[model samples]
Target: MGKREQAREEAAFMRGDVGVDGAATEEKQDAAEVERGKAREALLRGKAYLGREFLTWLLWRSESGEPVAAFEKTGLSVLFLGRVVLKGISGDVTELSARGAMAPYSEQVRQGMDRGLLVHQARLMLTHGEKAYEVTLDAEFLDIRAAKLPALMSEEDDSRTGERLYLAEQLSAMITTLVEAFIAVRAGRTWSKQVVPAMKEWMRGEEGTRKQTALQRAASARKR
Candidate 1:
């Protein structure tokens, strides 16, 4: 076979789109593509919890009144800001959003979390060492949206551009590291034995607060 013809056959083989003896491959290729797609769908559906849990855990940590995490011996600070979105795969109310300056620690966010919804997306203010970043984080895709980086220290055009790039890369790296840190802890036995239990305790506290708020509202209603 000539080089071009041989190349075409090899490419087709690599794609699993054809076989020897020139048998028709349309239906077979379509079946294979459908099977691959199904596998991908199943994988994503089953594994989506990891992202949700990581964001939820981060939000829980944020409520401790201070940034309370360290990575590779460096202190890191995370604050949920602007808007927080909580969602579950299946529910009567599948999604909820809390907004504004104090939205991160608001009663609605906590109550939603207590009800077993995970954080699907949230705005985050992150500090790594001395640098700060603001980003809206989407859990399922790990997307860093609407990012704000620290101010540049350079004035010259080339130098300023370089610094900006550096800051952007740093922002991305910090987020990736944070995700890796969460995954490590999640995979360890500590997640079940210690972490999850602690989170449940936090949730219980929220429930109590909600009950108290309900009582206050009822009392005020009666007075009115």
Candidate 2:
């Protein structure tokens, strides 16, 4: 072959190699994108699941008239969820509650979460978190840190303290969302229906023990 012919052949070979590399790179990028989407979906699903369980717990507790215990038990989880909603919607916490018990938030972001939670609280109530916990949540006074839902369903590891703090803020926001739902339900029920189950059921375990103690005391007194 002549010199020009050989040069042409070499160029063609290089072009073919480049074509194969490009195709592989594209495939890799597509696969990565797919994985990311799946991860995002999983995260959302997990949050929803956690939210539901918390709501149920709250419901049961409220019905039983143990709101304070319910609050303490699910406090952290609510904080996490609140933070997520806040972060996702870019809303405020103070508007939900003037209580300084929440993580700090910017004026703009607090407003966003407040608005978003007010709109989304009903769906969230029907979907997740404990029943009473949701009731305790209020959109106007929502805490961004109070909804710190566990990331187990869609664990998003925050590599930094700042990220964790952000998560805390979202959790608080979620709690406010629940509170809003509770108020709506309360108003609908005319605040007369038992927010919890029969008070007897709520006091069952402790009251039972107390009764037993009283009976024993009477027996001892008779013997004396």
Candidate 3:
């Protein structure tokens, strides 16, 4: 017999199986429900980000065509959002859901299968598109869960275990890093007067003196 059947037989022999069956069934159901909830939530969050990126790309492409540089920014945004969503869904939904709003994304993720879609790959396509910018971030974000596997001991319960807590902290750090990356990349691509030159002044310092000299020369001509 399989291990589960063997265990059930042993429990029945001890007279505990019949008595505990109801509780056991409830617990299993609860776990499944929780997992479904988490998957759904993650799915929604991922779709939201993916939707935004797709719409942005479509609009930009229609208007100006895709800028070669924009590929990196678009890809990175999708990657970062995907990572957060995956991290939100990594463990038991009960464990992660108890933490906060990130649980909703997990819930939406669970509903994906019912829609005849594979959550993981669809998430990747939304973020990556067709190019080098394709879904590099998507791959990295999904890896967060695998990276966390070793730390989540099977013998331990989620309530008593440190894994879930540690995962939350790691996810938070990743979000912060990605936000910074997004700002830097978008700023570079848009070349906004404030963002681009300000970043250069921050990074290169005093090199903008050449631009400043040219501005002065233009002013002098207007005076003459």
Candidate 4:
């Protein structure tokens, strides 16, 4: 074949129009891309549900007297603070916020859970070493909003800015680590078999545990 004709044929092959094998290669590539797209979509959907479930689990943990959860690797601890917001996932979309010592045990919180409401947001205090950060996290997107970081000890503007940035990044990393850990457990067998049942029991208030605990606290307060 002429050199120009040979070059054209090679280009056509590369374009997957000249041979069966070339066309098959193109088809394989297309299939791989589609698979990748599907995987990406599945990953995103998993993360969304994971976030929601994590929030619900956090609420359960708090009310069940395990509020001081830890990210052991990071030496960070999270305490669900006095404020929590639950939003209905279905029906009329009722929303409720509870505050103070009764927040976790509030009847509204229980009823909301019974009605298929998930924890939409929560206020938490995160402790790392001597510093503490207060942040409100949105469950659906895992967005941190209205965060209050510990004060920087530095007096100079540049130094203070650097310290603030460092603290913020550290807090962000802690939050990410905790969320990823929750997602891992939630996507595993333990979640459906153990965590979900525990959460359902808490929602049902099977033993009137929350109310009894609240009364005990009030009694203790009165004695003191």
lDDT of 3 by residue, 122-187 (tens): 211121233111222232233333222123444568653676676445444443344333333343
Q: Which whole-number lDDT from 0 to 100 does residue 198 have in model 1? A: 82
Per residue, candidate 4 scores C-alpha lDDT tens digits across 42-86 of 435655444656777765654433333355444655556668888
Better of 2 and 3 by lDDT: 2
Which model, 1 or 2, shows the larger lDDT? Answer: 1
Looking at candidate 2, what is the lDDT of residue 186?
36
- Whichever of 3 and 4 has more TM-score, that candidate is 4
- For 5-70, candidate 1 gives per-residue lDDT tens digits of 989888887787886755546664464456445434543464566678888988777665355566
Better structure of 1 and 2 per TM-score: 1
Give per-model TM-scores: 0.68, 0.24, 0.22, 0.66
Model 4 / residue 8 / CA error / Å: 24
* Ten-residue region with minimum lDDT total, candidate 1: 209-218
Model 4 misses residue 189 by how many Å? 0.7
Native-structure RMSD, model 1: 11.7
Top model number, lDDT: 1
* Best-to-worst TM-score order: 1, 4, 2, 3
- lDDT accuracy of residue 97 in candidate 1: 86
- Candidate 2 residue-wise lDDT, 1-224, digit = tens: 99998686667667663353334222344644564455344434554433432343343232222222223235322221122122223443422322221211223333443343222122121112432122233222222223323333334555555565654555455554444444344334333455333322323332232223323322432343
What TM-score quantifies how close candidate 3 is to the native fold?
A: 0.22
Model 4 worst lDDT run, 10 consecutive residues = 215-224
lDDT of 3: 0.33
Off by over 4 Å in 2: 1-162, 196-201, 204-224
Best by TM-score: 1
